[model samples]
Target: MSMFRHLLGVVITLLFVLLTCAVILPILMLALLKVGLPFARWQALCNRWLDWLASLWMDANARHQQLLLPTQLEIEGLDNLSKQEWYMMVANHQSWVDILLLLRIFNGRIPYLKFFLKQSLIWVPLLGLAWWALEFPFMRRHTKEQIARDPSLQGKDIEQTRKACEKFRYNPVTIINFLEGTRFTTAKYVQQKSIYRHLLMPKAGGLAFTLAAMNGQLHRLLDVTIHYPEGIPTYWDYACGRVKTIQVHIRQVPIPAELIGDYTEDAEFRAGFQLWVNQLWQRKDDLIESMKSTGAN
Candidate 1:
């Protein structure tokens, strides 16, 4: 049975990659055409088509997951969402399966979610190129030491954020930032001396910068909390239908006017922002504990 499940997982993984490559070919061509045509209306038309193709790809994957994985997904508070409204999705990071989960749940209910990717990811074969064409923001943060050596590197990420936000103004889009920065693991949990039992230290700067960058255009926040009752599962576990249940809770937070400020320059705003984030994470930690207690059945 275990061997059969493993083979099923392999087949699922291969089919997913094949689907991604198939979708990306037209994306590449449209991207080239958009580049060649400098007219704004023409570009906008191309953008719409790109979005349509991306939607088809996500829809395909959602069907694929539903057909193969028997994971019981229970969701809450996904109500009155519109593709015409802009949003910021802040979620905990746990596993690669989370991406698929998000894609499946939010596929048509909202506009496509744009992610902030590491700059190096643009070179990742097919999917990377699609991300580039679709205007996913790629960024790299410079360490203090690196900044000290190359003074010009300062504020590079901020500039990139501003540019990306400006483009997003033309279309209503949902931007996602995994505020924990990376996947959570026991080793990472201990390494950071994390105060939260189920999460890493929440990085408030990314959220703050995004709020600031949008200049109040993005006013609604989707506070997404994903819980796996049977421990966090890997992509393989999900693909093999080993994940029996999943829970997602979302809080539609209103972005207060006070939350938008220069996170890098304003000392008071930075302190306040961090406190807000800490309080939020604290609540999420408590919520996860409650979920564990109730979901263990």
Candidate 2:
């Protein structure tokens, strides 16, 4: 039965992706063609199309999940959010299914979620182009070693990020940052010797850059923590209806006036910002423990 459900999910997922590309690809092309135009109206029109297409895709896949799985979700703290506000959202990463879970939970409740894709993902076929059309920010983060080799590369990525954020100035957007930077696993937890029992170390740089780029426009910072009562499930497990319960706890964080300074150049602000992020992580880790204890009962 599980195998049959998995196969059904795989087929439906593939068909949805293919159908999305077929419909959105042309809009993407047209958006590109009109990119250089002086007026912003055409670009806005294209963006609306992309947002509509993305919402449709999520709605369809959500229906598929309902038909193929008996998953249960418990979501809290969604009462105060609006789809019309610009937001910067941070979440703990766990598995590939996390993305799908986010889409399912936040569909229509907030502005369409847009991820900051790894720069290399720009090469991915179809979906990559779709992301580009939808104006998802693609970021290439440079390491200290890479920066030492080419001093000229310093702050280049930040500039690109700023330009990308400029595109969203006219639109309401919910930008999601996986602050852990990667998925959590037992191996990873032990390797990092992380203080948090359930979470990897939160990376502050990405969130910092996003806040710096969006600045005053992104007033609300959503600190989202997700947990599975049974255990973290793989994408296949989720597709096969093995994941029965999901808990999503959202905390709306107000961007402190002091924390919104220049993250790239300011030293004092950097220290303060990192401390704030760590504090948030500690709280989230504690929250997960509390949730687990309650679930055990």
Candidate 3:
């Protein structure tokens, strides 16, 4: 009976998501075109609507399942944030549910969170249009093998960075990147013998390129650490209300002047940047341990 109820819940939630995407997205796109609005303006409006719709959807689901987020989610250093400032947010990856937690935590406090996604994802059905309307940066990454075959591909990554970040100059934006590149698995942790307790290897190149492109325009870094009380929860667990409480610790780190220069062409700077990222990850690992111990107590 529990399994049957779970299946029914899954079916209903999926149908709700699909129906909302199908019905609302097309109308939003056509409305933008009919009004002869520029893409960015349309995107901003679309994102506002999407956010509202998403919150409504999630709230309904949570209520149905009798699930509640912690009433007093401790957020340190949020008072340091300025409404007029631009920010770069970096966090450790776990599951798709991270997005929900982020939105719930920082929804009105910061400017809308935008992710650096792949260019191919821009055409991904309903979700694609919504993302496009939100003005997410669609990046193109060049693999080492590809760049090795054609050296010219080296600079192409920077060019993609410039194009993707072009709209930020006019808007106060918060760009979020998961430095680990992927979620942590126990098998991966064992294979890599990762330095951090709850994270994978940090990829420095992406962070280097983003900082170089944004330069002084980005003011602050929101370093977030998220932990699940009962092991690492999957997206299914999140939707099914298995995740009862989530602890999010936010720290504000300044963008140092030393890191503002071009990192791709400078070998020394790249190495330095990697070291800086490693230090940050080490601190995050310690924080995760502290949170887990506290929760256990």
Provide TM-scores for the models.
Answer: 0.97, 0.93, 0.82
Looking at candidate 3, what is the lDDT of residue 109? 75
lDDT of 2 at 294: 97
Clashing pairs in 3: none
lDDT, candidate 1, at 69: 76
lDDT of 2 by residue, 1-297 (tens): 767877866875675677676666675766676686746787677678778878887887787777767888898898888999988889999998899888988888899899989989988877778787777889888889999999999998888888888887778999999998889999999999998889999988878877778777898888899999999998877876778899999999888767678777889989999999999999999999999999999
Please report how far candidate 2 places residue 91 from its true position, in Å. 0.4
Which 10 residues in a row give candidate 3 its minimum summed lDDT?
A: 64-73
Better of 1 and 3 by TM-score: 1
lDDT per residue (tens digit) for residues 4-118 in model 3: 5477558646754765565556556654663476577776665556555544544554444344322234556567666567899999888877876776667667766788888
Q: In each prediction, how many residue pairs overlap at the backbone (N, C-alpha, C within less than 3 A)?
A: 0, 0, 0
Local distance difference test, candidate 1: 0.91
lDDT tens digits, residue span 27-114, model 1: 9899999999989999999999999999999998888888887889999998989899899999999999998998889989998889
Where does the lowest 10-residue lDDT sum fall in candidate 1? Answer: 161-170
Question: lDDT of all the models against the reference?
Answer: 0.91, 0.84, 0.74
Q: After aligning candidate 3 to the native by TM-score, how far in Å is the CA of 230 from where it should be?
A: 0.2
Which candidate order results from sorting by lDDT in descending order? 1, 2, 3
Q: What's the C-alpha lDDT at position 48 in model 1?
A: 90
Candidates 2 and 3 compared: the better one by lDDT is 2
